[model samples]
Target: MGETSLRRLPLVIMLLAAGCARQAPSPAPPRVETAAAQLPEQSSAIVVPVTADLRMLERGLDANTPRVLWTVDEHRDTCVRGKRVDLGIGKVKLTPDLGCRIVGQVTRGAIRVAGAGERIDITMPVSAKIAVRDIGGVLGETATARAIVHATGRLGVTGDWQPRATLDIAYDWREPPGIDIAGQRITFTSRADEKLKRVVRRLERDLPKEVAKLDLRRQLGDVWQRAFTVIELSKRNPPAWMRVTPRALGFGGYRIEGRQLRLTLAAEALTQTFVGRRPADPTPTPLPPPSRVAGQPGLRFFIPVLADYAQLEPVVLRTLRKLAAGGITLTGIGPVDVDFGKVTVYATTGNRLAVGVTARVVPRDRDFPATSGEAWLTAQPYNDEGSQLVQARDVKLAADTDSTAVDLIVSLLDATQVQRAVALALRHDFAPDYRKVLGKAQHAIGARQEGDFFLSTDVTRVTTGQLQVTGAGLFLPVRAEGSARIDYRPR
Candidate 1:
């Protein structure tokens, strides 16, 4: 009987060894699968159009110009040979001619300036009064004439941003100076027209001198320096900034409206966005020569909205836990419960995101062993253009364990429910941040003055780019588009 028992024990030992060999392998230890380092930051352009107001030039002309332009005094021979001159009182007979003296002055009125096409039209009013004496040696009378001096100023800017103009000056008498007496008229239009030529020459020479004093270079330099600084998009919450480093100046040309001359200077700059604290301003470079600008000029800048991975972890954990509340049914394994542990998210190469989840599977069947391991998943984050809602797409579950049971479980976890859970977990609504940033930008981008130069901007449109992940967090580049203008207001 002892020998038979020994034989049975040997068979039992063999069976036990077989059972040990059949047991599932131990689950791989939870690994911290780190994503690739964040990619290098890219930069965008900020092209702001600078509108220069030239109303001051008109005022300078008014201040520097003289009230009275020139005076006219002339005496000529009046002929009535073999003719009878009929005066209002009686007829006067002249043997040969009479000496006549005409003396008057052309007085200037208010200076008027208006924009016509690409040129500025300047109008100067003048009045001429002449006294005609010894008309036939019998009668003398006084006559008056009014005229307007017309000047067309072709405005231009030098390479150094100096205001320059070439004027074509001319004048016409509104009412010709003439004396009508004794049914005869004595006119002085030819003589007055000839005298006005001198006034035209004087104006053509002096007006440009005034325009040169506009000192647009100084004002433009101030604008260029101010543009080199940083602009705050948000003060707190997410603290974002845009550093503008001017690259070049572009001359789009000029236009005139009313008395204002607008010079379109496109300030081309390389703008980079920062998410955390304020970035240092870019060092100012010397204002470069004007470059030729193609396309329209406007303000373009990106406002980065970041969501820290640390902040997103808890949200993802909570979502995963909620989704896993009811036992997750594994195919051929019945209801398999899971206790969600920690969640780690980071950026990966190819603009993708890597998510690692530490989870312990609780088995319902005693025969099945409890398994604990991490499941590393990858996905692409994106958003629609101009939308603030960020969502995950192209989700893929990766196996990071050696145990066949755990791999099967992870395979089942890649089911629709788990994938949906992860997708929902990645759902981040940036609507509030978008509205706040836009509001703050619109308010902050308004009129900003430095000394006598007033810079104003009007935001016309807002756009958004693709979602980008970095070591810091998820960043959505929201761009603000608008037109900017700079005015020179001498205080």
Candidate 2:
């Protein structure tokens, strides 16, 4: 055979073996690689076709569904997805703005992602049914509960045996009035995992706003210094509030384990005393005439605060040191007493104002150990900026860890701290948001300024014997959302 004829024969044989035509399988559609772009201006739109390997997609959704009685085309199918769906088959084009309308027998297998464009209206036979279809990231106003959703922003899990992923947002079943819905609905996006990555970027952009929130969180850590506080210190205290458990996973947020947080102070910690008038020598003064009893002497002087109220003992104490310096020899000491005559509340307009007092004092008896014959007073209020610090006078005192001459400076200091904390928590916790720190995020790219996309600002967690707060020392855990511009290029 001629050389040209020989080469032709070989080419024909190879094409037959390689199966490039006729019974040959068509090449798999090129993988879709969407380019980043501005969301939409006027009818900004883009198109994506239906995928062939869809049953796998359906299984992914089934795994996310809370419950299901789903059904796909019945062909003696050993469908482990087990849900049953007696529906027709077909494909619908997707767009960007105007959501594409779906019409046809819903397959647990069908996956639809409509960006923005004019809707694709599908027309199915009269017996039409669309099972559960979940369009994640496209929130519908009012309904996805806030159940302390424990989330691991970077990747972690803790729940029931079924690996509950950060992507279990499968579509709960629903249908339009005239349309039909199978027993249950479970449809997931093809790139549900990718959504998690987007959240990381979002968090990075939102870190700043959390500054106020973080301050409050830290203060709570300081105040509640309960089992979560300087754990090592708690160990030193012995018999402390023993609370240890797996902290629920959460990113860009602080979880208050449960409500009705209770706080209390110890009575044994207070021990101090004040002084009043009495005789120095234990010898009973020559009995004053009974007339004297009925006179000024008859006037029973009770200084309960000067000493133990229960033990009306007249003991010499040092609350009044200048009296000693004044050379006024007191042949007697006290039952130096005090009482709060009234309790009134002051606040501004709306009256949602909150004011509280946390005081630790020295008990009367042991309070003034040295020059223990003086009166102790207290009234410290921490107010907002440009606001007056409310002060209360003559608050009865007894020596305790957080008490002092100038209003139990330690306790006042603590109260001052707590006041700041409470204010921040109430003010910022309710109204502040850090997501905006990522201002003007390319809304054009369909990204939102939400906690979902929050990122941390260089922080690390050093476990405190298993149960530990996210950040330690002076830093707060912030959530920065969206992208940032770093000028340096990596080596």
Give the number of colliding residue pairs in candidate 1: 0
lDDT of each: 0.70, 0.21
* TM-score against native, each model: 0.74, 0.15
Whose lDDT is greatest here? 1
Evaluated at residue 452, the lDDT of candidate 1 is 73
Runs of candidate 2 exceeding 4 Å displacement: 1-188, 191-193, 196-258, 261-271, 276-491
By summed lDDT, which 10 consecutive residues of candidate 2 come out lowest? 297-306
For model 1, name the residue pairs that clash: none
lDDT of 1 at 249: 80
- Candidate 2 lDDT tens digits, 433-452: 11221121122222212221
